[model samples]
Target: MDELAAFLRTRRARVLPETVGIPTDARRRVSGLRREEVAHLSGVSVDYYVRLEQGRARQPSAQVLDALARALGLDGVEREHLHRLAHRPAHAPRRASAARPRPELLRVLDLVADAPAFLIDHRMTVLAANRLADLLYGRRLQGLNIARHVFLSEEGRALFADWEACTLDTVGHLRLSAGHHPDDPELAALIGELAMRSDRFRRLWVRADVRTRTHGRKTYQHPSVGPLEVHQENFALPDATGTELVVQSAAPGTAAHDNLRLLASLGATPAPSAGGGCPAEGGDRGGALPEEVA
Candidate 1:
């Protein structure tokens, strides 16, 4: 199915029948709201909605798009995304080179010395990170790809206390990124690799979940400092459509904060080499660390 169609279907699947006052029926075979139900709710005919899903309909009017958005219960980000997919010109050519984070932005990351800060592109490539973030993530962040590390590396599972939630959120954010840059070859390759190497990633990808990371809390089972909870904040880089600076910190005066300070202290010290060096407790085992929390 086309991108717009697949996205609509997936969003439809997320809404329960009872959510919109639709009576649940035992005879229903499909998950979430059926196409007919959506058609009724959106004030469109079943055939029209079917054609939209089948990629046969004309460019939908803004009114129609808004109606459909409400019917699907899309959040602000998701709603904007739906409009973009519907209105985006087909097969548009893209720049040959992927955009990188600016040096000034890297300087900004440096200024946030006390917190774990890093820059990532839409594809979750760790463009650069502060020393604290480098120490926090270790080898996994070194390879530059966050999703790959989370799904493919054993250390990823050990780092995250809520591994499944982290994986799902990562996949969802990737999906959102894909919608914005549908023609990016590297993004396509990353998705293809994950789908091939990880069964969990494959399942989540097919669901077409989309999420935007702004601010959230995450629990990390830090190998060095034990368990810690940190607040993650993401800032979009100005003039950089696909790159973001992510900063993670714990509340002051909390144990988590003390652990974060300890991490910062460790980061200040020189890292030990693989042979005869002070290895991080349950560190990446020589694998690259994943990107900052999404």
Candidate 2:
């Protein structure tokens, strides 16, 4: 279910009405173009698109895959994701899922020069964060699971300006991911830990809130970089179950963008240093939403 839900959300977000030349008007009820519009543009049947989104159609042929890639206006990374989901096979018993990021993925994360990037499993742990990620958010993030830290730790609260909203939203997004990998023991243990540790998490988990995280703005109070506003992009890893390459970028020329680039250049960051320096520059803390709302 997690695999299916994730694929559907990814496919839907990758497409836009304007990408296919559809009029952007008040008639739009959903986030992106309608399923029928996507099918019509891609030369597939509406029923097929619906089936695919609903996760009922498991096997998409090569031709269908090509059509979806075109219709969704997927970039190189997204196109690869479409192919991966199309060919996903039902898992067999005794599956020993990975607790770390893939080696190839770590290489790719290092290759990213501009923004801090890393890979996170379903529970959103800091499995493989790069140097930049370590430098910026690394101080408070050390040895901490993202979900646990966000809801339980004071550092997490300080890092995020809108603490409650962001915590709730991220929890919801994690819920959606959990549904697809119910049998994955790592994910299960993560959920169990949260349930016991945080009362807020316990309530949210009981409500069964699930959300597909699409594009959005996230505010982080970086120790060195001060305040940074980044656009969060999650890309699925090829042949990896419940893994995503989470990349974050700031709008060009902003204070955060400039400071972050400088911080990255300095390099060789120490682990969780002291001092309350604000860098004398930052992003506006108002109106930044949580990781949910897709």
Candidate 3:
């Protein structure tokens, strides 16, 4: 299960004592370097590296992979690959270059400022999201990854009373996208990671139930507004790499709409992202969704 053992062995073999600026005081016994030396140089506990070398743990956390990558002196590409391997996500895979949305696609977003809007690939990467789009999703998490927030953030998790239900919906949406664009490297990587870490992810993925998410109603408790109901709209970008636009808004002329307007006037910016999850991207033209996720 620990497929990393072989790679880790090879890496240790290549790094000689003098090459990494480490002094080898003990008599070398093995063909490769000592485990302690590698552990020391890499800033990880010797036990952890040994566990990795022994293939004791099948899945390591992202932070652990980051530490190992630094210890191994891996470059950017190699480091990314290590993460890809460690997480073994279903949607992210090797890529030459990820597809960036075109300018006209952004122009269309500019027209939808009244609506809260954001774009997600099968990997749940927010390739492009407008200001208001960010407002709805960005506030709750330190970073944006619809999947990350769904699992990692407490407030984000609270949005859904039934965690399993939301998780299933998210993975199912991804599985459906994979059917449409099987070659997409990002999607492949995402699926792989979820499959490895979450049993629920794996179970839902196995069902092969494909569903395109579009219009729907959801209830959310906004930090500022208390609680609000929103109608969601999802549109798949035909030419884009299975990118879906998720938009949200409250009903017209209601009290919720007024509350959303009040919230928007607070000068909320798009989560300090390129688009910054602000209202300008599309915050409640009146009242919007629970949160934006870009």
**lDDT per residue (tens digit) for residues 1-294 in model 2:** 545445556566546778678888786678876778878987889998888888787778888888877776666544555565566456733324434444566678779878878766566765566677767765533234677667766766688867777877877767665545545687777778778878888876654444556567888886555888888888866653555778888889888789778878776753453223312111221223223111
Whole-model lDDT per candidate: 0.78, 0.65, 0.61
Minimum summed lDDT over a 10-residue window in model 3 is located at 277-286
lDDT of 3 by residue, 60-90 (tens): 7787777776666666645654554565554
The C-alpha stretches of model 2 lying farther than 4 A from their native spots are 1-100, 140-143, 265-267, 270-294
Best by TM-score: 1
TM-score of each: 0.87, 0.58, 0.53
Q: Put down candidate 1 lDDT per residue, 28-54, tens digits, no spaces.
A: 778999899999999999999999999
Candidate topping lDDT: 1
**By TM-score, highest first, what's the ranking?**
1, 2, 3
> What's model 3's TM-score?
0.53
Displacement of the residue 292 alpha carbon in candidate 3, Å = 23
- Which ranges in model 3 have alpha carbons more than 4 Å from their true place? 1-97, 140-143, 161-163, 272-294
- Candidate 2: count the clashes: 2
lDDT of 2: 0.65
TM-score of 2: 0.58
